[model samples]
Target chain A: MEIDYSNIRVIGFDADDTLWVNETYFREAEEKVGMLLSHFETPNKIDQELFRMEIKNLPTYGYGIKGFVLSMVELSIELSNGTVSNKIISEILRIGKDMIDKPVQLLDGVEEVLISLSKDYKLILATKGDLLDQERKLEKSGLNQYFHHIEVLSEKQEANYQKLLNHLDINPTEFLMIGNSLKSDILPLINIGAKAIHVPFHTTWQHEKVERNATNGLNYKTVKSLREILNFFKQN
Target chain B: MEIDYSNIRVIGFDADDTLWVNETYFREAEEKVGMLLSHFETPNKIDQELFRMEIKNLPTYGYGIKGFVLSMVELSIELSNGTVSNKIISEILRIGKDMIDKPVQLLDGVEEVLISLSKDYKLILATKGDLLDQERKLEKSGLNQYFHHIEVLSEKQEANYQKLLNHLDINPTEFLMIGNSLKSDILPLINIGAKAIHVPFHTTWQHEKVERNATNGLNYKTVKSLREILNFFKQN
Candidate 1:
């Protein structure tokens, strides 16, 4: 897809895996959880069951590490028939705590790109998840100085992007969104008449993975990393 | 403290406990948690320990039912010396889940007050805590129609209030905040030169309770209930 950067004014960036290491930690947590529940079921079966539980509980739990931890705990009881040992349950919790404590490790060239872009465009952090967790990560990221505003959305969808654009008094054609997930970060913005650039994260969650249909008319560019975005704007 | 509503252009409300039942649920959940841990320690001791754990975990959990549940789970292990049974743990989880599923019971005259004030003045729902939970409650409460804007703040300090007012482009003197917490809803706005009205909730969370010192000169009003706020504007 051909992309133009001349009209773009406010640039929005997705925080999670797009900005720093996020889904990798979730995968690590799941691996640890599968091992902990190995006594009750095979690791492969546990992974499948956990994925099923997460999909079922998304409406109730929403997204983020807190919800992920709750699903793991609930799955333990269901798998063990309410007979899971306290030691294993505690271990599961320990895994969650460790994930939360993990530092916000920014990906390669994130800061330099943000710095270069902020001079020319208004940058806003638009990400979905638990409010407190996201706020904490943003603070710890020490990249708050670059962005003009931070919007922690409940979910990223077509209506959500439209609402944000309307609230910000932004023209969709003049706005650009960069993120990892096509289902969340790309398709919705494209549907709303905004331009989106997909910066694929190394580890994508199963839920976020989507099959692109040939019939869809969404126009977007998939870059290897954030550093490559600088190539799109000569001034940057 | 004397309050003059004559110049007010917008009236802001604190959602939890002020417009609806919130702190009461926390109290109820705490009681259930203390009971579940009674076998491990004295109920009084368990209550004290839980409070300690909650305060300690506030930085990590922030303020929400999800954080409260995680604290309960953590405290259970400490109180029972890791001997807490899965049955009791599951019970604790159920207590938290029930709190989330509970109905949004708006306090007396909340809707009427909103409807009345919204006509004469722009009404805004300015509350703090979990963003998703707050959004859900607002949707379920049928109160969203009356609010010009609903802000779910992470914290309600003077700076946050200032930023909100600036975002809405309202003068401090032309705004009035009515809510149940002196620390969160009232004092901060007063400090920022905004008019405030304190409507005390029947149950105040310990974290929100603050001693009123007679030193500060900021003026505000304390209404008995939401219904009385209508009386502030004589034309209503």
Candidate 2:
């Protein structure tokens, strides 16, 4: 699918997976917890049990250290036959806390692509995560300078996308949503009559990935990587 | 600050941290990647290197896995002096893939609060994230049942909140934004004369935490948990 970048005045980008290393860190931590859980229960069971607790706690606690800490505590308690040790809880907390303090990494060709795109498109950083963590990552990553606007949101609902379009004073048809998650990035944009480019990342967070129906080809297109975006513009 | 739940004709929620365990997983994954980098250089040096890469990549990649995978590969190459092994790359990929598979965990009291609130207010799930991920999480977490309208968005700018109020056919003052992030959930709502109850989460993602001042006292109030919302409504 070809896109006319000239017509696209504002281009919005998803921050966590699109711009830098995000899910890998979470994956590694889950694996660590999974490994520990294996000592008591099967991996599948451990995941199921932990997931139940996570879902139950999400409304009140939310993502990040608080959520992770709660999950670990619950998992430890469950695995230890309701006898969670302080040592185990402490270790998990330490590991969880240590996770966010890690370094931010950029994807391949990100700079080249952003630089190339920014020359024409009004670049915006649209990401959904904890407010402070996302900003720190951006500041630390040094990517904060390139964006004309930075939006750190809670979830990527249609209203949020529409709000972004409204704030930019651009028509939905004139905006393009670019990111990896079909659930958060592409679908909402498509629903709102905006153009969307789905650059599929190899690893999607379990909750983020969606089953796609290739039959409906309307406002959305999926590309393999960021480099494909340039070609999309050139072709259109 | 107190609020009257009985007067709340409509209630909206912020997803991600508000509804589930999101950041901790990302944080954990980041820590692991950082540790891996430390094997090649000092923690601080690795952090600086990764930060530079992340900043450079934001415009090209938006958020989630694509950015993360690219960052990991870049980090591996940099740390390995451009001779990063396939094994290490595979390791990174493995970690990234694991994150996508982790189940969606909702926060504690989410169901209870939503169930109670849904009884009185026109419940809407106003969240921002990757569309597919948020939807799947809602479906799997079994919380989608409570919400009459579910909006997945890219960002929660003021316009989006206003649009939501318009869509719901409710006065801005009649709407309530309940969630963890003060930046996205509270500030935007407050900007438009809507009431917001901030349920502070321990680990706020970098991007979602915005700087608030004394001037932000008009339409916003911070609470410790979701359960306290009932009391807020009664007092007001």
- Please identify model 1 stretches exceeding 4 Å from their true place: B214-216
| lDDT, candidate 1, A140-225, per-residue tens | 99998998778888889888888889878989998999999998999888888899999998888999988878216667888998
Residue range A110-172, candidate 2, lDDT tens digits: 888888888888899998765456766887888766787677655688987886777578998
Q: Give the DockQ-based CAPRI class for model 2.
A: incorrect
Off by over 4 Å in 2: B1-236
TM-scores of all predicted structures: 0.94, 0.51
Fnat per predicted structure, each in turn: 0.42, 0.00
Query: Tens digit of lDDT per residue, candidate 1, span B172-226?
Result: 9998999999999989888889988889988888788887683166577788898
Q: Candidate 1 chain A — worst ten consecutive residues by lDDT sum?
A: A210-219
Clashing pairs in 1: none
B119-167 per-residue lDDT for model 2 (tens digits): 7678888876444456557877788779877775546879868766765
Q: After superposition, how far is residue B43 of candidate 2 from its true place, in Å?
A: 38
lDDT of 2 at B129: 49
